[model samples]
Target: MLTIGTKAPLFAAESTKGRIDLQTLIGKKKLVLIFYPGDETPICTKQLCAIRDRYSDLEAADAVVIGINPADLTSHQAFSGKFGYDFPLIADEDQAIRKAYKVGKILGFLFQQRIVYVIDKQGTIVYAKKGNPPVTELLQVVNQNP
Candidate 1:
């Protein structure tokens, strides 16, 4: 897990919204990177839907939300369309981003762990937590930096 104040690992990948370059987003918007195991699963769906439901709050804080999963672009597109999510869902097909963040599975599990990282405008990681962190907590963090 990446500690607070550490520089976030930069990545550029295809997403539902378009090509996303983490470096470009830095110094522009506070970012919330949602790393999950797969698309359309129960927990992952719930977690993303929660973000969808409160997306405006995230935007109000001048934050950009991006979800990363090992699923392909087609899967991510389908899932995002089904949920009407406006944010980008990145397809980490080769798991490079997952490996970069050290968000691999527990024990011998095949899926990545559910992790959330909040990065500030300067490319510094402000928060890193495993599992589904509350939307309120994330909003508070975003609002604080804005």
Candidate 2:
């Protein structure tokens, strides 16, 4: 997992809309990177939808919440459209971004460990949640600090 104050690793990933450079998406806003296990799974769905519902709040905090998963772009698009997700879902199909972010995976499974990285404007990871953090608390931090 990335630590606070260390610069976040750069990434250019496939997104439902198009290829997105991390820096570009974050721009001048705080970047909250949510790394999920996979798409359409129960917990993932709930967490994402929760975030979806709070898009405006995140935007108000001057943060853009980007979900990163190993799923392909097609699945990501369908998932986003199905749920009307306002934020971007990043397709880390090759798991490059996952590795860069230190989102370790199970040996044989395709799923990634759930983690969230809250990065400041300068790209240092200011906060990091290594496992399945309590949703309410995470949301609170994102909502309050965004």
Best by TM-score: 1
Minimum summed lDDT over a 10-residue window in model 2 is located at 137-146
- Candidate 1 per-residue C-alpha lDDT over 1-146 given as tens digits, one digit per residue, 9 for 90 to 100: 88899999999999999999998989999999999988989999999999999999999999999999889999999999999999999999899999898887864777899999999999999999999998999999998875
Q: Residue by residue across 72-117, what tens digits does model 2's lDDT show?
A: 8889999999999888899887788999988888647667998998
Query: TM-score of model 2 relative to the true fold?
Result: 0.88
Which sections of candidate 1 miss by over 4 Å? none
Best by lDDT: 1
- Name the regions of candidate 2 deviating beyond 4 angstroms: 25-27, 134-146
* Residue 61 miss distance in model 2 (angstroms): 0.4
Backbone clashes in model 2, listed as residue pairs? 61-146
**Model-by-model lDDT, in order?**
0.94, 0.80
How far off is model 2, as Cα RMSD?
2.2
